[model samples]
Target: MSIITTERLCKYFKGKKALDNLNLEIPKGIIFGYLGPNGAGKTTTIRVLLNLAKPTGGTAYILGEDIRKSRNYLRKVGFLPDVPNFYNFFTAREFLSFIADITDIENPKKRIEETLELVGLRNEKSRIGTYSRGMKQRLGLAQALLSDPELLILDEPTSSLDPQGRKEVLDLIYSLKSTKTVFFSTHILSDVERICDRIGILKEGRLLLEDSIENIKKRYWKRRILIEVDDLEKFLERIKESLKPNSVEVKNSSVVIEVLDIQYTLKEIPKIVVQDGLLLEKLEILEPSLEDIFLEVTSGA
Candidate 1:
């Protein structure tokens, strides 16, 4: 069953359309990735889904209930916003304790300790203000996990972190999938490629694409041939002889060659190089990376 669903969801601010007929369905136990560049409605969609802001049109349901009318439905959800705010005077422990109490979590003390440990903040003895950005992020994650909620919504959870801090957060998020559904929204395309089972790409407030990461790559990402040679001029001439016209673009000794048919390209490559008597420094099949796809999709918008 889908833990979250939106049908033709739309949101607008003044005269701007933040979201336009957006549709999303996230199944339980999947690490769903919501990806888009800034102002693409990723956050707006999240806000509407979480009931933080009402949608201007359409409807959304979370955990099988209408979010707009059911305030109690929020109890089963946990969220970490892009910039999580906390009481600077409160200690990490105290902040989590406060959340537990407010949420009416059973066994609040044990839950707080477990959540802190889960986020690897169990040993950090500092007030919220004293913590580093990474540490604060961990604390925020601990609070989100305190109730062991069924659905976890995170927006840019790893953004602005150092490499080590990013890894720690990614590791923690990866570990939570066995027990809860994760709806992760981020512009970090690589993170989505690494952790998401399914991804929804939103652009200009519409879902441009959604599929398993592998399938998306297979469908939208094409394999191309990269040829780095010692003889730039000769290689170009040789490619012109038998290859499709205008299929290659050269930059010095390297050329970006779009492989029309993988098998045919591989077969013809060696012949073309040999015909030119050029020494191939490197000949590789380049699959589209997430960065490549992100650029291709968003650049035109």
Candidate 2:
């Protein structure tokens, strides 16, 4: 069963639409990346799913139950917002303890210790105000996990961190796949590529594309073969005479051939090069990166 599902979900503010007939389904035990540029309504969709905002139209469900009808499903979910606020005076242990009490979690002390360890804050004894941005983010994640939720929703969880901090958080997020379903929204395409199992791209309050990383690459991206030879001109002529690629261009010291049929090109290029007596220095097929795909899809280019 889908852990989360939305049907023609719509949300409008005054006359502006934040979401327009957005339909989505996230299955269990996958890191689902919600991707879009700024103001693409990713956060709006998340808010609607969490029942933090009333959708102007349509429906949404979590754990097979409608959020509008019952908020009980919230107990099974955990959320980490883009910018998490904490009581500056409270230590990490104290703050989490406070959250546990409010949420009525049983065995709060044991849960807090386990969660802190999970986020790599087991030894942190300083106040929240003294912590770095990365530490604070980790602490926020610890609070989210205190409930031992089945579904974890995060909004741009690594937006402001440095490279090391991003790595830390990403590693922690990746570790959740065995135990939780993660649905995170981010404009960081590389992060999506690194950890996401499936992704949805939103643009102008609408879903532009949604697919697994591999399938999306195969479906939307063209394969370009980059070949470096002893002589660029000779190889270009050989390519023209033998392969007849859709497009061919000399880039720096190499020739890049764009082909419609990857299998045919791969099979035929080596034979042509060998026959023409051209020295092959490097032969590689360049697959389009997630960043490339995101720009092309969102820009409609």
Best by lDDT: 2
- Structural similarity to truth (TM-score) of each candidate: 0.92, 0.96
Candidate 2 residue lDDT tens string, 202-236: 98899999989999998876789899988788778
Clashes of 2: 0
Summing lDDT over every window of 10 consecutive residues in candidate 2, give the lowest-scoring window: 234-243
Q: Residues 178-235, candidate 1, lDDT per residue (tens digit)?
A: 9999999999988998888999988989888888888878887566778898887877
Alpha-carbon lDDT, every model: 0.86, 0.91
Candidate 2 wrong stretches, greater than 4 Å: none
State each model's C-alpha RMSD to the native.
1.9, 1.4
In model 1, what lDDT does residue 139 have? 82
